[model samples]
Target: MQADAYADIPLPIDPSALAALIGGTTAGVGILDTKLRYLYVNPALERLNGIPAAEHLGRTVADVLPEIDAREDMMLAVLSDGMSREITSSGRTPAATGADRRYWHGTYHRLEVAGQVVGVAGIVLEVMASDEEQRRLDRTRHHLSLLDAANTRIGTTLDMDTTCAELVDLVVPGLADFATVEVFPPDVAPTVRPAPPGVFRMRRAALTAVPGLLERFARFGVAGDYIDHQPGSAVPRCLASNQLVVENLTDDEQLGRVAHCPERVAVYRALGMHSAVFLPVSVRSGPIGVLGLVRAGGSPPFTAEDVVVARELAARAAVDLDHARRFTHEHTIALELQRSLLSEPRPPHPHIEVATRYLPADRQVLVGGDWFDVIPLRDGRHLKAMGDVMGHGVEAAVAMSHYRSLLRLLADEDLPPHRILEQLDRMVERSGLDRAATCLLAVVDRSGGMCQVSSAGHLPPVFIEPGAAGARLGDVPAGPPLGTGFGGYRTTEVRCAPGTVLFMYTDGLVERRGEDIDVSVGRLRELTLPADGSLERLLDTVLDRFGPGAEDDIAVMTSRARPAPGGCAKDLV
Candidate 1:
């Protein structure tokens, strides 16, 4: 019986060595059958899984540890190839319940019995350094997403106030519990001298707060309110230093020092504010203003990462604000230049009562080249001219100046209405100027009792007679606009009764979008102007009737014929 070779044998095991190896190691060890069910789990594996060994047995990895799916395919491959492989996987897990997500570097080996693959065994070691690294990576990705959104939302228009509002919207309830943007007025001219420190002059351009705390901060300020920064306030200090000022609202002393007023401290406490940061907004020119961000309770205190994010946001907003500022500066300069060039029209002859009006288009529309002038010509005659260049903005305005000057020079030479326009057309063509304009010229002769009128593709002049029902559009032959060199202008002579009035204007006075020109001009003709009134009264009447469409610039010149000093009307027909 002793020699009968394998009567009975117990499973071989070095219990002491196995215990030492398993107890000394911190890695998790597990064995899975071909069905991917957990058959064996060491004590370390049980602890890592947050489940006891007894509970894990006979349970598939997908059933017991679903978060480890990152390595499920690798484990299957090891079973299929009967080989060993190593993988590093990361994710939330049952073992990490109530804890941060974790990463595990795992090595899987095929387990065989009797030359047939039976299962896969894996040893997993936690990689702790990746925890912080993953968090940093996540934050970086989030910041990038925010910046991308900002690109489309910010600086959508060349308007300073709108840009400020956009900046506030992007940060509210996202970067901070509440935020405010302040800036100098849009009209403030840039200067070499820095802004006075103690003056505390700033326009609250935009303000926003989280939904829960809106009412608490509403009393602080609103957009467009003029706010004064108290002396030694965080805003002015941060702007002066061109740095960020972070204040810890949780600390009483720190909050008091930064609060600058008793009211603000009370407000902060009421709102349960825990932290704040004042970031300076600066561009190439200089500091524009400051962006104030505050956080409330339940929100974590502002960290260094928050400061970095705020600084980046401020940088982007500053560039947009600077662009808007420069646009305003240029628009101002262009307006001034146009005004200077278009001073008061020279006094018309005393024989006639003349009145004129010029209205530039609204801000959204570009400034145009609309102009009107009353020139006193030789031989006691008066010249009335109204012209509009065919463009808008500074270039059109500059062209208008040139056109006005040239017309004056030609009129001073005592040329007739058509001749003056002919010379102007030649000069504009020969000068190689690319601009085109429409003009109307009228010469009122009191001694001759007739008025000569000419047009270069301009709107027809209206003649209103005393006791007439409606005004009459003059039948002057329309010619090509100036710069066309089409010198086919012909002046028309009309009866110049003492009580008659001649009204001249640009197209802007009557034109409307999606309407025919004839219809617009017809509307003006249908309005009855007061015949027995002063030139100013008649001009106002005409404007009232057709002044609705001011999208284009408008210029109106009205000249009324007056009897010369207690004499009857002269007839030279």
Candidate 2:
């Protein structure tokens, strides 16, 4: 049969073009009218919306996709600001299908045919491919690298703003060509202030002088300029009036470098940037500053990807900066107080081999008030007492100093171990330290194989006697803690044989997840110290095994019963 001749004309766009572009992957692609009607949709949209593409044509977005949160900030930004946006929506498409949670990269743009806004266009790509095994591995490695760097820098003496700026510097360049960390500082609404043209130029040198920022700035070849008011500058003065402050200033004929509302254009120009985006920066309470990124608008400025990365990084960096500043200030006070409170370690005696180790917790300047005394008594005895006063930070350390002073006074007076506890109890009650405080006091009499101990809300000392199998524990007396007004508490005498080991400590030593406090202490008594011959190594092991979380500071004292020719018998007062 002879084929009939047919004349063909090119349509504005191919009917199958979208399907061909999206392929069989079922990626959602759709077009919307000014009224948000479903103007067009591919098969993927059909699947996502849970309706046939043909059925949805010419329907309003609200009419078809009822679940969409139209008022969302990002959505509002796209509609009102004409800004492009990408959203990831997971769940079964509105079409008839089982509920399936999957991520999508939904790009929204104002559809313009001949220059006027008609409607919106959307393209949604399922996140399946991006979540592939290899990508997961790469993400894991990147996250680990970032955490490693962050961890190392966490406890350093870096200031907040400088640290944040450095962090931004680290992220930019490899990621993009421009990055900035802005601090809004408290109570100052940046949007309301008009930006001055020469403001940037005025503060450029001063800002560049900042410590960490300069080094990292060299790393990325980026620079910074601050906004400041200047005399007689000719610029469309909108920084005092406009909200959206900076735009790409690549064109020589572009508007004068100043925002009517923000007034920071000249600073942007000096900083070698054309396009800049800003986000609020905050420490714990108030807004500390603003974070921003910039690039020459003519030179491929920021993209959706850039915004995504910048926002995520900024959130974490804000926290990091806040912690750094607070930690430094708090640490300075804490360390000074801790040092002042602790007694200087005395030189070793002929019969005593004393070992003391103190390690501050990770990234914090805080040293707990865990104090141990190795006092030589009047009668050739060793009076050892380790105490933990309540909490961490400065207050606890202060209380520690007071307790040590009182104990020393009692020791100097040569009071009995029981009497010392009674006097301490009275002193604490009178000093108003009875609220939220606990202490342990144990007197070790080396000459007499016994530990005369009276405790105030403290763990009893652990005693170990040598045997064929191993060392075993002796008896102890547990009583109410100090500061609780446990009236006239008596110290009990516990026997210690030759080569017997006595260990006393505060609660910081026996803390662990899913373990009872008593059981944890008992475990320490059962386990012998490490053979490495370092008390710090032993304490570090205890700390490492327990994981992270500090209940109280640790105070540990180890001693052995003196093997004497006359006999191990002296007053442990």
List, residue by residue over 470-489, the lDDT tens digit for candidate 1.
77888888899999998888
Ten-residue region with minimum lDDT total, candidate 1? 1-10
Q: What lDDT, from 0 to 1, does candidate 2 have? A: 0.56
RMSD of 1: 10.3
Tell me the spans in candidate 2 whose CA falls farther than 4 Å from its real position.
Answer: 1-299, 303-320, 359-368, 434-436, 464-474, 532-536, 546-550, 560-573
> How does residue 88 of candidate 1 score in lDDT?
87
All candidates' TM-scores? 0.62, 0.49
| Count of clashes, each model | 0, 54
Query: Which candidate gets the maximum TM-score versus the true structure?
Result: 1
